[model samples]
Target: MELRQLSHFLAVARRRSFTLAAHDVNVVQSSLSASIRQLERELGATLFDRTTRRVELSPAGRALLPIARHILADARAAKAEISAVQGLLRGQVALGTIQMLTWIDLPEVLARFTKAYPGVEISLLEAPVDEMIEALRSGELDLAYLACGVDELPAALTVIDSDTEPLAVAAGPDHPLAGQPGVRLADLEAEPFVEFQAGTGLQTVVDRLCHDAGLKRRIVLRTTQLELLASLVRHGLGLAVLPVGVAHQAGLTAVPIIGNTADRTVALVTRAGHDSNPAVRALLDLLRPDPAG
Candidate 1:
């Protein structure tokens, strides 16, 4: 198969409609479908199971989607890297972040990054911290902005100073205790809590907070997306612990947990040492550099 075929397949997979994928890739639907069919034929595997109303990945397709995405990403990176050798600012950077910051404004950071280096591509992937860390180590990601509290960085991963904020309790404005002056651990023991699945950074923080408070939280729901959790809170389903910044933008009442029980840190993580990729180094420098005189 050709690189273009993989690109076509990915577009189709993401949009889940051949017609829309064609518009996105600026190709006609027939050409796109032909390319995908050729790709499937070459691979000897069906990538998608289609119905008139919807398109879905088959089991094989589901497994191949991410691998295909990675391959396309690396291929694009390679092309961009070659262009950089000609003194042109070019090279792709894959950045991973948690869902909380997806709506954040980057000011000119992202704009300038793309404008000043038009040839370079920037792809952002949102996942839980575990998947982010795994992607970084596996070369699927060049850098990640994540919330981590472990004493040690992932092996061969370098940590950098990024802004951090505390995790807090968020509840709907109409919830019974929403207007309370302060929230105590004991107050929420029996409350239905919305939380991240186990092993995520914030989940660990919440678990520890409950443990230290000498109570166990009654977490009724688990989701990786903080905004979704906030929505659940707004629906009066349950309350959740989330980063203060995220909670603030989520339009929910966030009360700081009394005492020092709830807090988390956000940082930039990359493969460790000086041998880091130039694109990753450049982005880090842009984020944290000497003050302009």
Candidate 2:
């Protein structure tokens, strides 16, 4: 039916709460509910089955969800295409990233993007890899900058672009391993480790390396905050395996891990086949690395 009704219905479907969905679309609960009711009336199908505790999408609603998303996407793409040909790009892109990602100059990219298309709005959310992936699938995030294993990424999303960085052991300057040119995986067994939260890509690399080496590290600290992880390592609480650039920027000594595949690849990821919009394409272009030096 109407785009606003579809928008409101889609919001409710994703959030599963009329109140919260209303909050998301910036409308009063009654107005949002009325819009959904009108949509269901026009379609002659019950869109949602509500029972106070939670709202579940009815079969008809589930059937219409994808169709609705496509319609909204096409409408937005049409509007954006006309604006782009007129030399103006206008839309909001919700981007997700992991903590302490230093491989790419994101700020510089955003700076130039803003100068070029001042009409566009951008928002960033720093989260763990798994969470970002889920948000991308659910349409909460438009694009994400994250790390992927050497293996293929999940089928739900596709890699638009990527960059690689070496993962090294970071230690305080006074730590014994700090001065070493290359530290063996076995050598780290004697030292306690400062680690990131379990689902993080960096943590995955650290865990995989130790598991492959048949050695278990004694983890002294586990955290999600970058500043705290850097502080713990700075105080000699434990050694950390992180991107070499991040370690160097944090003023810690970085020692290469010996005989291991420890490179972390950070990718520019988005939902597979979700690149129809010009605004998203423009931002993705800016994010891509320049071909020429």
Candidate 3:
């Protein structure tokens, strides 16, 4: 029934390991277990099914997960609101982002936010788009940076800011297609490609472009590291689709696609109706583009 019990229960439900959840919440396993037991007793429902090898959420736990998240979010928002009334922001803001940090100018935004509200703590987590969206939905992240086409987003999410940029086909200087003008997606049908892993937003964009072009890319390597993917392309291992700035910085020859088949739209996203944290709001304001620019 207590907020602390709900907090412990949510950690356990997310991690599915009592020890891991205990570590996450900075508490001992026994204390966390006792809290979950107390919560379950108060609710008159079994929340987890525990075994020697694994722990799984019971039906009741699944049902309570979203409710617990909402309660925690509201509590945090209330605390932040109270703190803001004292002319100071003091709370933790967890932000999620993809790998393209430099392009987003996130460090600059962070610098401004920390300088303005030194008491507010900030944590940055990096994950793929799908994972980041899930974190936002689950209340693990107050804000997230994602990449999409900028047309429509999921019902549970809202875009704070979006910037659309053209995607470029990157190739080694010595490659046959290097410096080629007007390179269409189908032009690289037989070319090997080095791309991000399946779950990443960049990979999704590449897949969609190839699918629309009626071609399946010959992916020779799949990796999570953007620098490594660029390195592979630089070494003539395979071609890749990348943001124009990133491709040029990696010293790869970047050519624009002939059609509007591939473009990168980076968006700052948050849960649709959960924007009450003062720290989160401050960061979002700093990230917003200047009207004069």
lDDT of 1 by residue, 41-115 (tens): 998999999999999988888888778767875675565466557444656677776656522344457787777
**TM per prediction:** 0.71, 0.71, 0.75
Stretches > 4 Å off in candidate 1: 1-81, 102-104, 150-152, 197-199, 272-278, 289-293
Q: Residue pairs in steric clash, candidate 3?
A: none
TM-score of 1: 0.71
lDDT of 3 by residue, 1-293 (tens): 88889878877876678987787678899999999998989999999999998999999999998899888877766776776675554676888888854455788789888898898888776766766777788777888888765565678888888887778889988988885786888767789988887777777887888788877789889887888988899899999888788788788998888865578788888886445666777787787788788
Per-residue error for 206 in candidate 1, Å, reads 1.9
State candidate 2's TM-score: 0.71
Number of colliding residue pairs in each model: 1, 0, 0
**Which one wins by lDDT: 1 or 2?**
2
Write the residue-wise lDDT of candidate 2 on 1-293 in tens digits: 89889879977886678987787678999999999999999999999999969999999999998788777766655655665575545676768888768857888988998898898877676666876776677665788988776355677888877888998889998998877899878766788988888787778877887898777989878986888999899999999888999999999999998888778888888886456556677888887777883
Best-performing candidate as measured by lDDT: 2
Deviation in Å, model 1, residue 15 alpha carbon: 15
